[model samples]
Target: MTRKKNSGDFLKECMADALFILLRTKSIEEITVSEITALANVSRITYYRNFTSKEKVIEFKLDKLISQWIHEHPRKESASAYESSLSFFQFFYSIHDIVQTLIRANLSVMLLNRLILKFHDFNTPDRNEYYRQIFISFGLCGIILTWMDNGMKESPEQMAETVSRRFFPQPEP
Candidate 1:
């Protein structure tokens, strides 16, 4: 049973990888299941078994990537906006190629929506604080999307500093 599950997981990963590779040169709508299956060296039945559509495959990949990112970063509620933004930009920059492809395809909203959902903190005790987290999630998503749109010219440190200054202004002396 474990072996079967592992094989299924492997096939799903292969299909997801193939779709992203094709996405670099072709829009998501332009690439069909046949193309993905061909590139992945898998059968149509395999593709159908694993994913409902190309969009589903992309969502699966994004979810996996976000899960990995969360595990690695483990967001701290105590971290300042600058620290959080720095890590966010650094991580996204590392995967900028995949991001750029998604942007070019006009599917950037997928990233934004996924990030908003993933960044939410479920354990918040106060309803107001929960809403605050939601707002922060949207704000963070906006900042990253804008950075990607502008070709991410600034270094992560530069971007983080700019965001920190704008969002959390210091009082005058």
Candidate 2:
């Protein structure tokens, strides 16, 4: 009997689990498509049908998560700039594990760089939002890396509050 094709979600989940396993054991440079397919217990054909490369898998996962968060918890039309910043940080914290894993895999920095560019395009300003977004993204990534290196001592909520305070300093009432 012919085996059924895995749904898109199922393939993505397999890829994610494979990534975690690969990140735990090997450097990103050493990982191959065959390894991912083997780890995921799916055929090479299946993996090729889903993603072009391992890097694409990581990028796809991050993009999907970011898009989903933006769709699900959109900032209020009347929300202040500070509120919007806080909301984003909160959403990032909610996905801290995946973030941490990606960081550990050395993909977080690359992903953050892409996000910085995207954020820049979204907010057109004379002051160079591109530079600002790059600075903020790198800063947050650094903070998370340090926290994880130290064993994630604080809760995500606590980290989010601290980041919000630093990035979106309270404005005068």
For residues 1-173, what per-residue lDDT tens digits would candidate 1 score against the true structure? Answer: 99999899889889999999999899887899999999999999999998998988988888888888989999798998789879888989988887888888888889877886787765878989888877878787778878888989999999989988898766779
TM-score of each: 0.87, 0.73
Q: Model 2, range 1-173, lDDT digits (tens) per residue?
A: 12343476678778867976787768778988888888898988988888887777877777777777778876587875456656765676677777777777767776675565444464656457657766777776677667766767776667767776776777779
Model 1: residues >4 Å from true position, as ranges? 122-127, 170-173
Point out the worst 10-residue segment of candidate 2 by lDDT: 1-10
CA lDDT, every prediction?
A: 0.87, 0.72
- Candidate 2, which segments miss by more than 4 Å at Cα? 1-6, 80-86, 117-127
Model 2, global lDDT: 0.72
Give the per-residue Cα lDDT of candidate 2 at 79: 74
Give the winner by TM-score.
1
RMSD of 1: 2.3
Cα lDDT of model 1 overall? Answer: 0.87
In the predicted model 2, the residue pairs found to clash are: none
